[model samples]
Target: EEKIPGVYGIDTRALTKLLREKGSLLGKITFEGGEDIEFHDPNQENLIAKVSTKEIVEYGSGDKTVVLVDCGTKYNIIRCLLRLGVKVVFVPWDYDFTQMEYDGLFISNGPGSPEFAEITVEHIRKAMEIGKPICGICMGNQLLCKAAGAKVYKLKYGHRSHNQPVRLVGTEKCYITSQNHGFAVDNSTIPSEWEPHFINMNDGTNEGIRHKTKPFFSAQFHPEASSGPKDTEFIFEEFVNLL
Candidate 1:
């Protein structure tokens, strides 16, 4: 046998089968003669601070101004908003923008658990108090639910793929969506003012939420799918209309 001290082998089929049957899991790799490593859960700390912008960043110069909370936001989200002719103001996840004049507040997708993003939750709470149009994607979805007095929990495997199917609640319309997250909002915990807007067709998990009397809404998937189907891109237009 070849004496390779740091060789590794991965059985893709086996891993896929395991994930399909058991959902996503945490594991670690090790070498025979190397130091043992431990699996560290990324959701245990404040991940938003690590991925959010350090300073305020602006994009476009349109009439509608949107204060986007940058919690590890995806670039396509900003690109999509800019394409709609909206001025985008990217702020750190922990920064306060409630006092700023903006037509809407957008929370961007990011890594980690929403509970760890306590500051962002507080900011969203403040935005609700102001009653402006608010929208969120991915982790933004969970944060919005939490701010609205709902609870969130980690999924068994989580939805993390393109082509995930979501259906509009109380309707037969369904759309393929791009998604990436490890947690979901507990639908049963949502307050009366908010209701499930969309649900995953495959797993029946909450995919989106909307407020009954407020201009607040969020999706657990990316409407601005960068390299995926554009089936739900109209959601952005609807949000812009709300503004």
Candidate 2:
């Protein structure tokens, strides 16, 4: 049984259509005799701080070490890296990871706007100069863009499915992906030194970005999709290759 209170029997299809047309809306589901409540917008909150680990955590023991900046990261992300024989040093969202010795840096997916994680972005800027291989996923992608001076904005309704199509930049190849983010990087605002790595086929939005000549890149989708397509699992390999 569902633990949370819920009101059912509504036309979910109509609601989905309305959301598609009107974008993300804030609303409260009220049951009979329930008091009216204000709809809170989670986007304005620093959800990363709330969900990120409070202290440093390490997993596995491998020669190649990866400092994973946890911003509400999925367990599958760590599992994927650990599968690659990477010793993972999981840290908090705002932790200063630049000081730690590691072969690669990874920014994991998280919730809410990238603005709240400015501290993490600052650390990323430092990591970028350090020249260690770096990879980011979802909100991590947004933070990397922010570190590079690119702008990020909230998406309309957001991408939340396993079948989203993405095309490689400057190539004809396309991959079906799993995604669940409500913000996107503004390609037009992306700096000259960095270029788009992937593009969303449906909306033509930037799905990924990479530095011109550095081992720095990020994807706005989940490559460690346990229940979704395996096409992008190669992404973890690509990141490991950088290490």
Residues forming the 10-long window of minimal summed lDDT in candidate 1 = 1-10
- Looking at model 2, report the run of 10 residues with the lowest lDDT sum: 30-39
How do the predictions measure up, each by TM-score?
Answer: 0.92, 0.94
Error of 2 at 124 (Å): 0.2
lDDT of 2 by residue, 108-151 (tens): 99988889999999999999999999999999999999999999
lDDT of 1: 0.90
List, residue by residue over 151-179, the lDDT tens digit for candidate 1.
99889988878889999998999999988
